[model samples]
Target: MKSTKLIYMILPYTRRELPGWGKLFENLGGYKSELWKDAPIRTIRGKFHQYLMTLDLSSWHERMTYFLGRYYELDIQKFMIEAVKPGDSFIDVGANLGMITLMAARCVTPTGTVHSFEPNPLVFKRLQANVSNNELQQVTLHNCGLAEGESELTLTVVNEELGMGTFTKIPQQDESLISNQYQLTVYRGDDILPEELPGITFIKIDVEGFEPLVIRGLDRTIQRLHPVILTEVVPEHLERGGFSVKELCEIMQNYGYQPLNISTKRSGLRHHLQLTKLTDNQMTENVLWLHPENNLSSRLEKYFKES
Candidate 1:
């Protein structure tokens, strides 16, 4: 068991050192055969680290393997590892398969707790399995979604792309693509109050296009805790969800949150954090929202400056 763990940890580094080694490995007859063969679940070590993921070679899984290269959003993963402190409370809204949740749990170990919320039953089961297999004691999994209110919403699950599930109302023209629609109960962050969420320092939200609604529901939490937020800023998704990207930025600005572009440069793990104006054309996959009052901004600035 110890040897297997060591191999998993070292495999990522080995791939990094060899450059294109992952592609070469994937092209091998033996590795290609495993991908084609029928398998319900196959545990694979991450490309950048020892993180384990149980995949079924579905669209989402294949996408992760090819595009993400197993690490899954390397920049965001690094930011979480560096930004989150021990004992700090982290929230993973739209936790998906527990990738960020698992990473955060490792960063804020011993005393910290990671709250992961995933509404999709099929994806939620996989998330639960990954968290359990890794034995992440710091993670607390929730089976519901988070929104602006405590109402049941229709979740459109795309069979081909499970990760693209959205609670937002879909347009009539695109309704034919929905594989299934399930009723999911969503609760506001304020609804949980100080008891359920105590001193939340960091939050990562990626709910397809429901980002604004989720932020709307967490207004109270943001006003009080002023947690550092890492969220997706996809304009099309936001528009489909009945909210504009401009509105989302305005809401964050109203709450004293400043938008910054956190990108990983070509030179190693260096992060370029720049105060950015949220424009429609400037839409990126992820952006960091920082509160001026919190010392986190200064800390992150210092880290980047030093690095």
Candidate 2:
């Protein structure tokens, strides 16, 4: 058995249901990650494909996927599979380690194209490695980020997983906490994407608190393509970046888009997500927005258990 598995064996299978207990078990096993800080890379087979990742218990993304063989968010994973069809063009903003990008590659097939953007150079390297290891030819990766316009900006990466990155003017944290900053270039999706990669049908934006800027950058493309967008909408993250949930909702509404909250069940072996229309008062962390004119929801009605 792999060393990582030995530590993960005690971790809860139903992570969402038993987070506290899971952590207790992990602590009992000394899997607080000091144990395998230098462990060898392991082969982990996921729902979509296998990954050659350096498995670690410390990284939340890895820990959940290590146990489940997929991303922690079951609904978003299911939606990506259902929403993106073969020969469709999909974009992954803030692609992280290319977990979603890898899955999208499988869905799109060789005929389709998947464009992934990652600003953190280290994470981008892993993203490139994963895509190459999987030998997905349809994917085109950019080492920079997309934004309202072309400009140089600072990227703040706050964890080992490199998923919690932000371009926001963040508040002052403790001096002891570790953060790495890098200068990155940003481009407007309108000025470049349409001419290079036309016919984009789907986009997933998880750019920490910079979600609003990304949407603004791709405003023209969204108008033209009316692609299905899966964007993160955490209120705290938005506030850190000087954005608000109300502003995000208004922006989408003005663009003729409606929202459905994306989340997973509390506990389940089979991970299938049902989409329901979100009300104005609902607090949404992740929202899947689509234009009524495009009528995209009509085609994917099986997934919606609207209440």
Provide the TM-score for each candidate, comma-separated.
0.81, 0.86
User: What lDDT score belongs to each candidate, Candidate 1 first?
Assistant: 0.72, 0.76
Q: Per-residue CA lDDT of candidate 2, range 1-103, in tens?
A: 3555565555344333344545654554444566556645555757554544444545655765766566667677778776777888889998988888888
**Per-residue lDDT of 165-237 in model 1, one digit per residue for the tens?**
9987777878788888888788997776344543448889999899999999988888878889989998888
- For model 1, the local distance difference test gives 0.72
Error of 1 at 49 (Å): 6.1
Q: What's the CA error at residue 121 for candidate 2, in Å?
A: 0.7
Give candidate 1's root-mean-square deviation (CA, Å): 5.6
C-alpha displacement of 206 in model 2, angstroms?
0.6
Off by over 4 Å in 1: 1-14, 17-40, 47-51, 60-69, 193-200, 268-281, 302-307
